[model samples]
Target: MEALGDRESWAAVVKEEEEEEEEEEEEGDSANNIGDAIASTDDEDALKRRISAHPLYGKLVEMHLDCLKVSVMGDVAGDLDHHETRYQQQPKDCNKYPQKMLHQSDLDHFMEAYCVALSKLREAMEEPQQKSMAFISSMHSQLQEMSAIPIAHSNAPAHPLPPPTSSSGK
Candidate 1:
């Protein structure tokens, strides 16, 4: 089955298989229509609850890639256009100019920025764990308080009981 018998036979078999799959996917009688599964949900609140309960719902990184560059004047403009002339001018010794491609200051700035981002990610990951630990500690204290209540009651001196009534005359 792995070997193609011939172009005509293979094409015929693939076409037949594709048609079968398309038919299966398009069938309205089946309740497992993936395209309509989420849309057909009757309860919006339940869907939202389920989505929020997802582990990665709020943890995924949201990237901003659509920022627009605005033209600036003065030193800021010079800084923005600093690399334009470099790209326009051809280097004399391109092979020996690796240092020109990247400066030590640039590397240092990159490392600092990377460390900041790494620390931020670590803090984000640890925040939930810290909150859960605090909750557990509070619960532990409450349990201890509850258990101590019973002990305190047990340790209290017993109340004096009234003397038994004298037996009636025979």
Candidate 2:
């Protein structure tokens, strides 16, 4: 009779342990699911922040900026080429004085505007590169500081490890 009671009590304890394990697993799964959902969201700022936190963020940004700079430079080159072509295509004879002067003035103003636009674009590109450089420098310093910390065996003696003994009597 006593053995039967012990068996029943043991069975109840085992069942309770299994229930607790199942609950813990469920909690873990839910937590992982929440993290996944957060990662999949379409928030631009959040994505930028996450990318900026990554180790390769600086390189990625630099490459992207380089591509943009190249594209802008290409555009400027094309515009200049088009302007030159247009100028060459114009008739050299100025039979109509007022019309000739007006066309020349308009062409000069357009060229000036193109130069200003190019300058602005270059300045804009430079600002982001400078900011990214500063950010990358700060991140590198932080990583260095983190690595300098002795996380493991910190409580151990400061003495260096003993040199190994030679296997063959040297």
**What TM-score does each of the candidates earn?**
0.29, 0.31
For 1-170, candidate 2 gives per-residue lDDT tens digits of 99999999999999999999999999999999898777777565554544434433333444444445545555775765565556557654433334433344544554456556665676787788789889999999999987787846466677878999889956
User: Which parts of model 1 have CA positions greater than 4 angstroms off?
Assistant: 1-103, 151-170
Best by lDDT: 2
Residue 97, model 1: lDDT of: 30
Top TM-score hit: 2
Q: Candidate 2: minimum summed lDDT over ten consecutive residues — where? A: 51-60
Q: Give lDDT tens digits, candidate 1, residues 1-170.
A: 44656877989999999999988876853656654666567556554543333333222211100010122336664654554444335333433434433344544455456556655665665677679889999999999988877543775666756889888987
The Cα local distance difference test for each model comes to 0.52, 0.64
* Ten-residue region with minimum lDDT total, candidate 1: 60-69
